[model samples]
Target: MTSPIQQPSRRAVLRMVAGAPLLLGASAALAVATSAPALAAQAGWRWCERCSGLWYSLNGTRGTCPAGNVFDGGHHSNGSGNYILKTVEDGGRGQGNWRWCGACQGLWYGGNPTLGYCPNRGATGHTPIGPYPTISSYYLIEDVGNRDSPGGQEQWRWCYKCAGMFFDGNTPGGSGRCPKDGYTHSVTGGSYVLRQVP
Candidate 1:
């Protein structure tokens, strides 16, 4: 037979009253944790293992790589780390005038009068869609200092050799290909950090 239920002692009742705040605090903390927004990231940008340049990989065609002949004369993305580029829509913290080359599918700096080199489009420079000043659709990339934020992949630098952005992370394979110099890309200027898609 079950024992008769006994009323809680005064000490037990007092202890529960004291612990109520702790329970409420835990519940509030949990609600905040669940309500926080998840980190957002942009995708479709990738490192070309063959050309050492950053290229947009969302197209039906893989686009040309200076290294050449890897996959149907296109950029090789094998072993590439997926990168998320910050666009102008995100904020104005980064630089703009970065445009995608339709001819080669690589990112080129269009701020200068010179459009930069394009392997697929010959030495005449990359053939980007849209007119001068403001390209129809331009991409803005963030330039970061030595200290990178959480999930920010550093070691990306500008290649004076190709006038393109390439990954120079401590890759054992060495800096990827550079079409202009017909060799690995040479990093110059400050290091850039690209946000890695989590």
Candidate 2:
């Protein structure tokens, strides 16, 4: 009998060739597994040497993606706290929470973590006090050409059914406000004059 290696049968060789895909696929998967972490480090995906999984950084400096936190439209307050802001949807899981209108990018990197207020991306200060004609608190904003530095203006409004106040840093004066348009409040009589945030 000829040696198996020296005289391999055509059928055996064909089987080996047919199995090549499985072997190659396994090798490719292994390569990806070994290389993924490096890519995460190089490609700017969120990484936590201390963290277990994917994360985020506004300026690629810091942000956390904890195991319990959800990704889409959520936030990594500081390099740890995860607050999935609900502005994009209806009242964040119905708990009634609002997010600051600042750039979320800076909010994590430049986060004070001390103050009750957190700044958005690249923001150096808190919301300024100014005047406007209407506000929505949603509903984003559009300055076109104003002067607080760049953007436009912001403010908070009273909501009835939600029975709370939602701050709108995007829109100033709303087309309509609560009590002025049939919304109820506990106002004996108080006027909220425009006050600058000093």
Candidate 3:
């Protein structure tokens, strides 16, 4: 005698159908959570007016600023609003020096005070005491691909007297005269020499 074929009970089939939507929703949520961090790694920088701070965004989506205002993509400066927007190239590929400014409490480009003051503060003095414990720190960004030799890239430093950034490699031992302040500061060593690695 042949065995009779069996089917799923009607209740079992109905239970599975009822759970389908919940299963799909869970899967979607998992997908988003898993991908968020990866997206954030690739996101560039953004500036927020409300918080007067810089932020990062992934695929143009960012959380509300601390002050609850939206972020601005391009550079912007609003004196009345007391906010400014700027972007720093990812340190992945660049040749320059970064320094810590005690006055502005932020990192600045070049070794001198002349490359303009920090984002928050006005201009300050650039002394040649090899980075000062009171104000400046050593933050250098050297281009591995291009050394400061022959036809390679030149070393840069900030000049406080001139209030501008200057190439120090042109002079011997990275000691160059400031256009406005004359010969004073050395662009080689400073207080904290903090090196940033990519």
In candidate 2, stretches whose alpha carbon ends up further than 4 angstroms from where it belongs are 1-24, 36-38, 41-104, 107-198
In model 2, the Cα lDDT at residue 180 comes to 20
Regions more than 4 Å wrong, model 3 = 1-140, 143-152, 158-164, 171-174, 179-181, 190-198
TM-score to true structure, per model: 0.69, 0.17, 0.23
Please state every model's RMSD to the true fold in angstroms: 16.2, 23.5, 20.7
Candidate 2, residues 1-198: lDDT per residue as tens digits? 011012233344445656665555666545544431111111122212221122224343343212124443333333332211212222111212222222222111112232222212122332211122221111112122322133222332333222223223222332122212232222221211111211
| Candidate 1 residue pairs in backbone clash | none
TM-score of 2: 0.17
* Model 3 per-residue lDDT tens digits across residues 34-152: 43111212213233333332222222234222123234422222321211111122222233344333332223455433554322232343232222333222223344443222222
Best by lDDT: 1
Candidate 2 lDDT = 0.25
